[model samples]
Target: MSTPDTVTVDGPGLRDDPSRPGPVDVPALLAHSRETVGPALRAAVARLDVSSREQAEYHLGWVEADGSPGRGGGKAVRPALALLSAAAAGAPAETGLAGAVAVELVHNFSLVHDDLMDGDRERRHRPTVWARWGAASAILCGDGLLTLATEVLLEDRSPHAAAAARLVAVTTRELIRGQAEDVAFERRADVGVDECLTMAAGKTGSLLATSAAIGAVLAGAPTAAVRGLSDYGMAVGMAFQLVDDLLGIWGDPAVTGKPVLSDLRSRKKSLPVTFAVQRGGAAGRELAAWLAHTGEQTDAELRAAADLVERGGGREWAGAEARRRMVAAERALAGAGLAAGPHAELLALGHHLIDREF
Candidate 1:
């Protein structure tokens, strides 16, 4: 949330032409998005019963477990993307505020449930809703958030609201499917990189795709342009997950709010891990054997496993793939006919997100 502004956009985009956009302040864009949609998001959550409201507020980083005031939510990237989509269509950013709130709601809803399902005890350096409260409470809270997401959009009187709501529903289904696949992968050692990439496309890409295009739907942008933005969002989402997979293995706990090599410790068949295992070399075999073992790994073992993943080319592959996806995102944006400023903003954001470090 405290990230700096002034992101220099990489990747080929409309900015390549001398008459087009300049550097975008991604942090300012994100901050403006938060200012635009955070209240709507909170007000929507306020509709939940008190029991659910407290848990929602806590999990949303609005308060501490003891109900004390606190400040920390994610970078609010989804909402930012939604609002930017509308701007790209030459509409008032406010036209996309509902879409922004709805996507943010669904995102947080998934986070609550995902934390419970993954047995993750911490988020944003605080105890997760399930860990601090109870699993039952966490489930109900997630349900409340998910329901509110649709309700918020449906409450809008815009002619396009229904279509946007429907899109959110469909995208949420894909997200759930991807999550299921991710969970199932834990029980099998035969997960392939292609399969893992497909899973990431669903789990992460679908929602982002919606976030990118839903604003256009709400603003009634041309169908082809909306489709282009959706395509751009998909590529950006894949890049994001690849970077996440890398962070899961090598992120700084002080920044990521999780232990180092956390995914390896859990034996998570992440994209990079899957790629490395499928690479089939000495390092790959060692990594596969380590993953197959059903015992808690030592600190040394975790570090060594991280090395094996790198040696097996998982780290390099993930990094290169992330860059490739960024390029794809830019290409999609170039043909989208988006307004120059918004197009520039979107491209800068994609770069900033995929290039993010923990």
Candidate 2:
């Protein structure tokens, strides 16, 4: 197997590191997000009745299937990014925590709905909300989280509240469009590179961009700085998707918590597979035929298709593209004129996106 390139050093464990300085405090970021955002989410659910509160808690992974507290919630990366970006932009990081909470809630909301749509059974190494609570309950829970996210955005008394609302509106719409495109691509054979990129940007990139933009807006950053941060977010978002696509094909199922070749088994029109189809000749046709087949294929057939994608340069192409985007993200961060310390951390984050093994 061809070895993939390494991107950046991994962050510390899930707890904050007081000894560490600069942007390397992923543990600290994660801890802060959990402490702050976690409470806000719980309070949001508290306003509802006991049954609804239980459902919301369960979906947040804060409570068990029986509505008891659980251990396997998310890493809260989106909110951390928002708060970090705000801090880097010169505002008190705490000021942006609510925005972080809002983004993370919306993200979890999307994940719950996405799991339902994709018929996914597991998330964060546990049974998905839909799998545990059934589809109807999951859908309602997702709706509730989304509603709470809007409330959080509006609750912020900052002047940027209006802009944050606009960001949320645009991000939500883009997410729906991206999800629609993804579903449509599954049944179609003619998906192109540009189309896939567009879908990825909408589905994945929009939220990240909004998160960064929210930070800048809350920090009272200049318009140019906000635009730069948005660009940085977009580039990182693209890299994130490319890396995810790579993991879907080449990742160890044990670590990924999913079946190996899961995307291939489902015939997902991921970037590598789509690029292979567009660039590979007869081999590509064979792969497409396999995808079009209604019956399940043997393990060997799946391996052959994966081999075709690798041999056709799809994997390499995607990897290279991810690197290119990481570079672009770095340039954008530099242009944003953040302090050297935070800027370095953001740059490391860009590299980390492309380099993550999990």
Candidate 3:
């Protein structure tokens, strides 16, 4: 974990930090978010059919594949976003608890379905929901989560309840659209940069944007403040996905908890890969040929493909683009009118999102 006084990345966009007492402690914030959101998810799942409930619980890491107690989960970024956004809007963080749980449920809903669609056998170093519970159960579990996300919001009975639910629904639709495009891209050989960016914004950016905005809306923030939070989330979300794409090619398997070149192995059309192809250089040509092959690539071939991606400037371009997005995020956050504490925490969180190793 990075200390508040940690010397972070310095560039045109990222502001220098002297010391902070809030969002710099990412691990602590994540733990706090999980504590708030986890029980809500568990209770919601408990209301479902017994078998489906078990599957959902397993997927959520509340239990093992064999129904034993276990501990495993994501970094809780979405929940933290909701809580922080509420604080930024001058509301108590507890007021956003429902919003945070809804966002976490929706996020896990996407994960369950994505694993099935991608034929991914593992997630968080465990067998994926589909891999362990079968496709039917996995699909049901995902449906259950989506239902719970809306149900939690509807149960709130607050003035912004309907609006928040609407936001989540709209974002979920975009997510589905992005997933459709991603599947279609796998079958085509000519995916362009613009299309890839659109897909990324929908699949990854929309939920995160909504996550950051919902808390503000629930807190009855002014319209401009809510919009600012939304824009900040969108920018950070794009930057986050870009970093993820970079890590897919070059990150250590131990740190990422995945196989080497996992994205390449899956033939994912990640941002860096798109940039490499768009460059149309010798390295791009070489990479295009490797991408054309349908057979499973050897480890050596995967290494060569990664080399081509980096040599073609994909790595540098993505890093720069991410930093630019970070700058955009900072600008939007500045307009959110948050108190110093929330604003500083959000800035730190934004920097952490871009500068993380895994």
Candidate models: Cα lDDT each: 0.86, 0.76, 0.81
**lDDT top scorer:** 1
lDDT of 2 by residue, 1-358 (tens): 1213322223321224423442354445466667866777677767655555676677677777764668757777677677767766767666676678778878878888999999989776678878877898888878888887888878888888768877887799999899999998877889999999999999999999877767768777888878888898898899889889988988889867768887888788899888888887776777777777887878787888899888777889888988788878878887787755455555555555566673
Candidate 1 clashes between residue pairs 3 or more apart in a chain or in different chains: none
Candidate 1 Cα outliers beyond 4 Å, as residue runs? 1-22
- What 10-residue stretch in candidate 3 is worst by lDDT? 9-18
lDDT of 1 at 67: 64
lDDT of 1 at 346: 84
Question: Which lDDT value does model 3 have at 114?
Answer: 97
Query: Which pairs clash in model 2?
Result: 16-27, 16-28, 64-68
Can you write out model 1's per-residue Cα lDDT over 1-358, one digit (the tens) per residue? 1223454543222222424445676676787778888889989999999988999998888888676786868889999899889878878667888999999999999999999999989887789989988999999999999999999999987799999999999999999999999898878889889989989998999999999888888999998889989999999999889989899999987766678888898888998898899994999999999888887778998999999999999999998998888888889989989877777778778777876574
For each candidate in turn, the TM-score is 0.92, 0.90, 0.92
Candidate 3 lDDT, tens digit per residue, 54-137?
Answer: 877787788887768978767788888887788788887766777888888899899999999989898887999899879999
Q: In model 2, what lDDT does residue 292 have? A: 78
Candidate 1 has an lDDT of 0.86
